[model samples]
Target: MNAHAATDTAASSTTALPLKEQLVLVTGGARGLGAAISAAFLDAGAKVVVNYRSSSQAAEELAAAFPGQALALQADVRDAAGLKDLAAAAAEHFGRPITTLVNNALVDFSFNADARSKADELSAEELTAQFAGSVLAPVAAIQAVLPSMRQAGFGRIVNIGTNLFQHPVVPYHDYTATKAALLSLTRTFADDLGPEGINVNMVSGGLLRTTDASAATPEEVFDLIASGTPLRRVTSPAELADAVLFFASPLSRGVTGQNLIVDGGLVKG
Candidate 1:
């Protein structure tokens, strides 16, 4: 489906504020797609914790726009203890356990093919770093939230991923490999947490039209991607952000361990 149509579908499918009385913690929620995701939940009348590792100014600025509905905090997701502190801080700030967790924090990796290391040239350290940042970070955050989720018998965990794995038009080895592992973790978590009323899922996006990271990509590349998609345009961070809301809402209470690809039909789910 086209981006607009997909959004309409999501809006109709959403349950609004199934967790209206609870809090949401979005890792890397300061900028890029993370910003949109945080805003979406806030617009739905949910309080949010916008977590950032370094973008303090940007994070605070964004949080200011929402006032009491949102707050910005800093934590490196790669640190398990740090994730614990983040969850504690967020619960203290909102006076509630976080009912939703979005693992949107990303490691420092570039989409520039020339700068990316090929399989043969990629270092063990590079792969390990990506894993720690992407996979282990979410694992830590999930672990941190499990106690509360179990207590309440409710939770939502959305892991942001790339649709590149579905369409490997670009050889982003390290980034894609880490996301693949994360996808696996998403399903496993879903299975393990289903009985406890926790849902784990993934929202994968293709080349976003323009984001801080994709800004470096050539315009010609964006046009090429747009032309190939059925929508004849690249997906926007806003659209992907809306898609991420699905799993968090009660509309998706019955859905888990699923990957929804939002790439303008360039890559089918």
Candidate 2:
């Protein structure tokens, strides 16, 4: 079949398997925002593969809550072989192909504006590391799951981005630049994969109220951000996770190659 025809085939095939039946693999799903995303998928009645590099205890604990519906696997997102193994193991355990992927893993980063490396002080190594985790990792993951998704003719790839791309309130130079690059990948991937019935999009969130990475943020900074937003409150991990669910869910079937900002109206895009 042609690319367009194949997409139609995949679209028609997906109607039989709703969100509740989807098999979702979330990278770095053992803690913080990753944990929330895993929980959101599980709560929606989808089988989740929680992939974590470390944080075994956290990953297992989160999976334990859902019993048979969730599984915790170990894999570094930057490793293509590991990601491929993770996909195979998840399918073997869940008895189905992975239908959705959430690229949420990020390198170790803190939200302390004061501690940020200034432009002149930043090193190429720092940018390279962020690129590995933020951009290359997602690329590896998408490659690992492409065969299954293409065969099934249905896939949802949601990349976790940052509001810093639009509003560079804090110069997290390395982190923000990599995320911007990921957004470019998001759009290009959407165009390339849409013909195969895969929807690639991005969810960019502001400084969350509390995540492991944001734990070091000053109280005043949080308040300052909240006061500047229309919601007058910081966004929660759960709230951001829900937006991911929307993309994974059938409700967003027609939407692709777009970036949805879920930061309490902080950065309107």
Superposed by TM-score, candidate 1 places the C-alpha of residue 117 at a distance from the truth, in angstroms, of: 1.1
Quote the lDDT for 231 in model 2.
93
Best by lDDT: 2
Question: What do the candidate models score in CA lDDT, each in turn?
Answer: 0.85, 0.91
lDDT of 2: 0.91
Report the Cα lDDT for candidate 1. 0.85
Residues 46-100, model 2: lDDT tens digits: 9999999979999999999999999999998999999999999999998889999
After superposing candidate 2, which stretches have Cα over 4 Å from the reference?
1-17
